[model samples]
Target: MERHCVFVTIFVLILHLVQAQNQTGFISVDCGLSPPESPYNAPQTGLTYTSDTGLINTGKTGRIAKDFEPFVDKPALTMRYFPDGIRNCYNLNVTRDTNYLIKATFVYGNYDGLNVDPNFDLYLGPNLWTTICLVKTGISIPFINVLELRPLKKNVYATQSGSLKYLFRMYVSNSSRRIRSVKMGQNHGSTQLNSTHEP
Candidate 1:
């Protein structure tokens, strides 16, 4: 009986240790920014983008833009990449021995909310990216909160240590509603995700 208890305790301890190694970090926006003009002008469309009013460059520069502040209740914000979904992107620097827990959130006034894969397509270095374990979204008073598209986790081996440059982005097929705010959690480099700071 004592031996059995000892084995059980050892197993539990190992499990806890492993869990501790995978703590997540948060990614939020500090400023909201917009591109001076439609970034897609290359396609030769007449669509023009205002510095803070439109979605051409939806970053910290946009959120803090004079016109964009009302919808931007929080300094940390998110942008919905529509027409060309998953096209809304941001760069993050990571380290080797750590994995990232990436979560994407969206909001709506009244939306069907479809077409968000919420996966890391581009990795700065060797990635520990994998498995969409969770996907969930719901409504709050002012807007519907769509979050946890996937509780995805990645593993970085010992050899994979140091700075990693990456892009975390997503898209939506239909334009039901666009809530431009999301929070990201990380195991390392939380400061890099600070949106308003600038590159």
Candidate 2:
């Protein structure tokens, strides 16, 4: 075979192998959001959350008609199906030796000019969320990502078998007017499972 053709074939095979190992899924959940006493930036359709019940008739229309009106908005969906499950949904299955970037996405909008604990806490399988500080004076943090959730960061954990399993949960412990959500994502790695070195 020509040198170029041989190289091209080898590259394609490796690409497929890598892609096969990395899979992604989306897990979603639905809860509720409290309307701010004085909503200035609330979407025209008003913002609300759902409880993920199969029944979609959560009076969403009535709220939209009254608050959203012609604007035709309601609330930001906080939860959703991470597909097979929430954990490992965003990124593909994890194996030892390969590095990955797991991102957590959040959406929130609450400003009382004071410190406010989360309206709820998200449970990612056995992984515990440490905490995040939004004490930027007048800055109202309504959203966050993995990078934003920096306080309880975990980058490296070791395992002999080279695999991990996880799930996700965004439960509201206290009723707050603020709304928010969580998501996950994954990236390519330099090595494969059981390999001595990352690719």
Candidate 3:
């Protein structure tokens, strides 16, 4: 009995260690930033936010954030912008057969001082993720976070409406696969299926 208990404890420890490693697979992007710029100061979030200037091959610089006090606190995250485009994308290498919580945050600081608010769309590769409306301060816009049982191969993209400029952030949260699909978009629909992994 004692030997069995020891074996069970060892198995539990190994399972916990595997879970810890899986939880570390995450990516955060500070859109519209160039190299040598500091990362967003949010270590408490356990995610590293990096510049997206050279990371992707689209988007034009429209504004900077040093002038806005709301952005000054998270300079790396807010100090850049991506103007309207068909599809601005970033390709990332993630673990195969894993699930992820993909989140994109937008804040229009009116950096251009134009006082104009705009709307745009977000995408996950060929999939039409959702649309985002940028509003001024004191007003909150509903954001979307997609839970994807990401195929071993996939890409993420962002689209703009060409009406106005804005700044945003992208966060890819990793989690163990539980459900098949969780959809959040204009259609308001969902489907589920069982996933099987072979040894």
The candidate scoring highest on lDDT is 3
On TM-score, the stronger of 1 and 3 is 3
Where model 3 places Cα greater than 4 Å from the true spot, the runs are 1-23, 38-46, 62-67, 71-80, 127-199
Q: What value does the lDDT take at residue 179 in candidate 1? A: 33
* Model 1 Cα shift for residue 36 (angstroms): 12
Measured against the true structure, the TM-scores of the candidates, in listed sequence, are: 0.25, 0.24, 0.46
Q: Write the per-residue lDDT of candidate 3 for residues 1-199, one digit (tens) a residue.
A: 9999999999988866754444245565666555676364444333355665545554444333445444332433343344544434455555543434454544555556764433334444322222222212222221111111222212322235311122333323232423333333332321111122222
Q: By TM-score, how accurate is candidate 2?
A: 0.24
lDDT of each: 0.31, 0.29, 0.40
lDDT of 1 by residue, 159-197 (tens): 244333334545443455443544444533322221111
Q: How are the candidates ranked when ordered by TM-score, highest leading? A: 3, 1, 2
User: Could you give candidate 2's per-residue lDDT for residues 4-62 as a string of tens digits?
Assistant: 99999999888667545422321221223333322222243222222323322122211
Once model 3 is optimally superposed onto the true structure by TM-score, how far is the C-alpha of residue 19 displaced, in angstroms?
Answer: 18
Lowest summed lDDT across 10 adjacent residues in model 1 is found at: 140-149
Write down the worst ten-residue block by lDDT for model 2.
190-199
Deviation (Å) of 35 in candidate 2: 22
